[model samples]
Target: MQAPINIALVGNPNSGKSSLFNALTGLNQKVSNFPGVTVDKKTGTAQIVPGLTANIIDLPGTYSLYPKSADEYVTYDVLINPDNADIPDLIIIVADASNLKRNLLFCSQIIDLKIPVIIGLTMMDIARKKGVEIDLDGLERELGVPVVSINPRKSKGVAELKKIIDLAARGNYSAAPRDFINNGALAKPVTDEIKKAVPGKSDYAALHIAVNADELHFLNIPQKAAIKQTLQTHQFNKTKVQAEEIMQRYNRIKHIMKSTVVETDPLQKQLRSEKIDDLLLHRFWGYVILLVVMFLLFQSIFWLASYPMDWIEGGFGQLSGWLTSVLPDNKITDVFVNGILAGISGFAVFIPQIMILFGLITILEDTGYMARISFLTDRLMRQVGLNGKSVMPLISGVACAVPAIMATRTIENKKERLITILVTPLMSCSARLPIYTMMIALVIPDRRIFGILGLQGLIMMGLYLLGFFMAIFIAAIMKLFVKIREKSYFIMELPVYRAPRWKNVGTTMVEKAKIFVTDAGKVIVVISVILWFLASYGPSSRMQPLHDKYEKMIAAVPADSPAADSLDKAFRSEKLSHSYAGILGHAIEPAIRPLGFDWKIGIALITSFAAREVFVGTMATLYSVGENPDDNNATLREKMAAAKWPDGRPVYTLAAGLSLMIFYSFAMQCMSTLAIVKRETKSWKMPLIQLVYMTALAYICSLIIFNIFK
Candidate 1:
C-alpha cells in the first residue's frame, strides 16, 4: 500500500485557507504546538477517495516566503525544510480570487520550488461581484499548473481538489512550470554553492537557505557557517537578489494575467464595503460606534443570559436536593453532593454567559469588523507602547487571557509584545464575569438610570472599561521601565466586509465552550475535592467538641422547629470555622481585614489562586455545607446576602461587596494565565513579578474603595 498522502494547505492571511481546511476535514482536526515553538500546528485527516486517506496540514498564514512574526516564520520554516517530518507530498495553495494579484505573489514563489502545486481558488463569488473574471483553462496553461476554483463555504470544487491532491501524492500529476524567475549570473555562484551544500533542493529553495541560513532551524552550526562563508566569499547581496527575483516573478505574472484574466475597472467606483467604511471608520463617529458596540456587548452579557443562568442555578439546586434525599446520610454522600457536585454546578451555571460572550465575539470576527477595530485603535495603542497588532490580543483578552497572550505571537516587536502580554490580563476576561455579576447583584441597585440601560449592566460595562483603561495605563508605565529599543509598525489588510458565517460562528461557540468546560473544569474539580477534605474534616479535638455541642443543642429543640433550624446553622458554621479550610482562611484574615474581607472571603481568595472562577465554586461549597438541608433550594446570592459576621453585621454589605469587586477586578488570580505568561515570555521572572504587582495593586484598590464606601 502507498504511504499515507501528506498535503500542506498554504495561503496568505485571510485568503480563505482555513475555510477550505474546515471544509475538507470537518471534525477530524487536532491542534498541537510546533516542534520548538509555541505557535499552533493544525493537522487533520481526510478521505480523498474510498481507499485513499490524506494528512492535511493547515500551515500558519504568511504574505511571503520572507517571514515577519513567529507565526509567519513557522510557515516559512516548514516549507523550506526538506527533512521536516510533516513536509507535504503535495502543496495546495489557497488564494482569494478577489485579491488575485497580491495572493499570486506568494503562489509564484511556491511554484518555483518545483513542487507538485495545485491552485485552490477561493472567494470566486466575491471576485465576480467585483466584476473580475478569470479564464481558468487559459491561466492553467500559462502557469503549467492545475487550477480549481472552489467555494469552501459551499463545499464546491472540494471533490475535484481531493482527486487532484491524490494524483499528485502518487506522482501521477504534472509539475508546475519552474521558470518564474531567472537566477541572474550574479546569483549563479551562491545558488550553486547552496545546491552543493544541500542536494536535491530546488534553486529557489537553495537561494532561500543562503539568504536566511541563520534563521533556519534545520541547519546545524557547521552547515550555517559553511553557507555563510560561501555567501561572503562570493560577495552575494541577499537583499538585492530577493528584490530582483520578486520583480521578475511579478513581471512574468503581469503578461500572463493580460491573456488569462479580466479585472474590473477599480478606478471607476468604490466597493460597497469601502462605502460602508466611510462612516464606520470616520474618526469621531467610529469611536462613538465602538463605544456603543461595547456597551451593548456588556449589556447583552447581563440581560440575555439571565434567564438561562437562573434555570441552571435552580435546576442544580433541585438536583442537589434530590441527591440528598436518595443517598444515605454519610460522609461519602456529603463529599459527593457538597464537594464534587457543588463545584461542578458552580461553573456549570455560568456556561450560558460564557457561551454568549464567545458567540458575540465570533460573530464580530466573522463579519470582518474585528480587523477594523485594530485599525481604529492603532493610534491609541501607539500611545501605550504597543502597535496596532497589540489591539487584537487586548480585545481577545476579554474572552480569555491565555488565548489573548498566545495571540501576542503576531506582534513582531519584542518589547511591545512583552508589554502587551504583561498588561493583557488586566482586561477583564469571562472568568471574572461570574464574580462581577454576583457582586453587582449583591450591591448595585437593579434600576435603570438612562431609562434604557440597566444599572447592573452599566456597572458591568464600567468594570470592563475600567479594566481596559487600566491595561493601557499599566502598559504605558511598563514602557518606561522595559529598556529594549526596537522599531515597531502595524501593517494589515482589511478584508472586505461580508455577511457573518453562521456555521463558523456556531462551531467557534461550541469549541470555546468545550475549552472552558474541559480546561477550567479540571482545575475546579481538584480544588473542590481538596476543599471538601479540608472543610469536612477538622482537628479531632475541635471535631469532637463541635459534635458534642451540636448533639446537645439538637436534643433541646423539637424536630422541624424554627429553633432547630437556627441551631443547625450555628452548629455547621462553627464546625466549618474550626476545619482546616477555615483555619487557613483565618490565618490570612488579618492581612485582608483592612480590605473588608473576613475569614470566609479569605478562603475564597486562597482557592481562587487556582483560577478566578473557582471563587464562585469555593463560595458554593462553603455555603452549601453550612446550610440547613431543607434550605438547599436557596440560590447562592440569597445565601450570601443572609450571611452575617459573629458580631451580627451583614457580611456582604455595601462596603465589603464593593471592596470584593474592586479586588477581583485588579487581582491576578489565575494560575493558568500565569503559566501561559511563563510560556510566552520563557521566564518565571515575568509572571512572578506580574503576580506580586497585580496582587499588591488589588489590595491597595480594595482598601481604598472599602474605606470610601464605608
Candidate 2:
C-alpha cells in the first residue's frame, strides 16, 4: 500500500491551528505520544481529494523555528530531522490574519525550509473587525505560496483549503519562489560549513543545523562533532546570527505587508480585546469573578448532573436486578451481576459529572477566558517561583496528571517545572470526582446556605480549592529547596474573547466521557471482578466450617421463618469476614483505623492504588459480594449508607466519610500517575519520592482530620 501524504498543520499558540485541524479531520483524529517523546501527537486522516487521504500531523503550536521549550523542540525536530517519519510532503501553515506580522515570522521561517507550503489564513473575521484587511492574491504573489482564507470555527473556506491541498498533492502548487531571508548571509561561515557537512538541506535548514546541531537528537556523533568543530573554528555568534535573520525577515515582511495587507495603527484605538481585558483582567475584580465562576462551576456539577447520575444509578440497579432474576443462580451469574455490572455502573454513573466538567472547561477555553485566567493567576503563581506558564499545566492537572505532567515540558525553567510536576498531583483530577461526590453526598446535608449556595456544592468546591491551595503550598515549600535559580518571565498572548463553540464543547464532553468509561473503566472492571472473587470465596478451612454450622442451624428452623433468614445473613457476613479480600483489608485495617477506614474501605484503598476511580468500583464490588441484587434494589449509595461496625456504629458517619475524602484528596495512590511521573522526570527517584511524601502527607492529614471530627 502506498503511504498517504504526510501533512503538518503548524502555527503559533491560539492561532486557530487546532480549529483548522478539527475542521479538516472532524471526528477522524486520535491523540498519542510522539515516538521517542512523551509529547502528545494529534494525527488524523483528511481526504484531500477523492480517494486520496493525507495523514495530518498537527505539530505543537510554536512561535518560531528557534526552539525553547520541549514542545517547540519536538516541532523543530520533526521539521529539521531529515530522516524523521513524520516529515511532511505538504505543510499547511495556519496563520492568524489578526496577527499577520508576527504570524508571518514563523511562516517565513518554514517557507525558507523550501517545502511545499500553503498558508491558511484564519481569524479573518477578527482581523476585519480590528480594521485589518488582507488581499489573498497579493499575499500569494509575495509569499510565493497559495494563501487561502479560512474561518475554521464556522467551517468556512475549508473546502477551498482542501481543494488547494489537492492541487499541491498533484504537484500543481508552487513552492516558495525565493528565500524568505538571505539565510547564507546571516552566518556565511557556519551555514556554508553546515551545508557541506549535512548535504542536500536548504540553506536555512543548514543554518538551523549550525545553531541547533548540538541539541538536535537526529544528528549522529560524527555529524555533531563536525558541526561543533566548524562552529568553533568560525567563532559563530549564534545570538547575532539569529537576530540578523529575524531583522532581515521582518524588513522583507514590511515591504510584503505594504502590498498585501492593511491594518489600523495601534495608537489610534485599542482593539476590542484590550478593552474587554480592562475589566476581565482587573486584579481584584478578576479574582472575584474567578471565584464566582468556580462557585458556579462546582454548583453545576451537582445541579446539572444530579438527574442524569440518578437515572444512570437507577438504570444499573434495574439491570443488576433483571440479570439476577433472569440468569440462573450460579457463580457466572454472580460475577456478571455483582462484579462486572456493579463495576461498570460505578464509573458509569459519574459520566454526567465528567461530561459537564469537561464541557464547561471547554467553554472557558473556547471563549479565551482560560488564557486570561493564566494571566490573572500569574501573580499567585510567581509567589511560588513559577510564572504564568505553570498555570496551564496546573489547570490541566484538574483533568489528569499524566498529560498534565507531560505539559510541564512547556515550562522552560527546570526548577519551576520540576516543582510544578511534583505538586500537580495535588490538584484533584476528575478521577477523584466520583469519590468526592459520593462522599460529599453521604456526609454533607442536601441543604443550602443563605438559601442560595447548596452545602453539598460548597463542600465540593472547597475540595477543589483545597487541592489547588495544597498544590500551591507544596510548590512554595519546594521552591525553597529546588535551589536552581533562573530568571522567569510570563510572556503570553491573550487571544480575543469569542463566543463558545457549542459543537466543540459537545465534542469535548463526549470525548472525555468516553475516555473515563473506556480507559478508567477497563481497570475498574478487572479490579472489581478480582475483588468480588476474593470477597466471595475464602480459605476452605475457615469458610466451610462456618457454612456447615449455619446450614445445620438453618435446617433445624422453619425454612421461611425470620430465624432461617437471619442465619443466612449471619453465614454470608461470616463468609465475607474470612474471605481473601477481607484478610487483606483486615491486615491493613490496624494501620488505617485511626483514619476512620474499616476493612471494606481498607480494601478499596488497596485496589484504588491502581487508579483513583477504581475506588468507586471497589466499593460497589465489596458491598455487593454476598448481597442479592434482585432482593435489594437499593442504590450503591444506600447500601454504603447502611454499613456498620460490629459494635453497631454506622460506618458512613460524617466524621468517617469526611476523613476518607480527606485521605483520598491527599493520597498519591494512582500507580499510573506514579509511572507517568517516572516517565516525565525520566527517573524512578522523583516519583518514588513523590509517592512517599504524598502518602505520608495523606496519612498525617487524614489522621488529624479524623481525630478532629471524631
lDDT per model vs. reference: 0.87, 0.89
Q: Per-residue CA lDDT of candidate 2, range 451-510, in tens?
A: 998999889989889999999999888878887578989999988888988988999999
What would the TM-score be for candidate 1 when compared with the true structure? 0.96
RMSD of each: 1.9, 1.7
Query: Alpha carbon lDDT of residue 705, candidate 2?
Result: 86
lDDT of each residue in 469-567, candidate 1, tens digit only: 899899988988986478777888898887777887787778878977898888887788788889888999889988998899899889789898888
Task: Evaluate model 2: give its lDDT.
Answer: 0.89
Give the Cα error of residue 31 in candidate 2, in Å.
0.5
User: Which candidate achieves the best lDDT against the true structure?
Assistant: 2
Candidate 2 segments exceeding 4 Å error: 1-3, 264-268, 628-630
Model 2 clash tally?
A: 0
Q: What is candidate 2's CA lDDT for residue 153?
A: 94
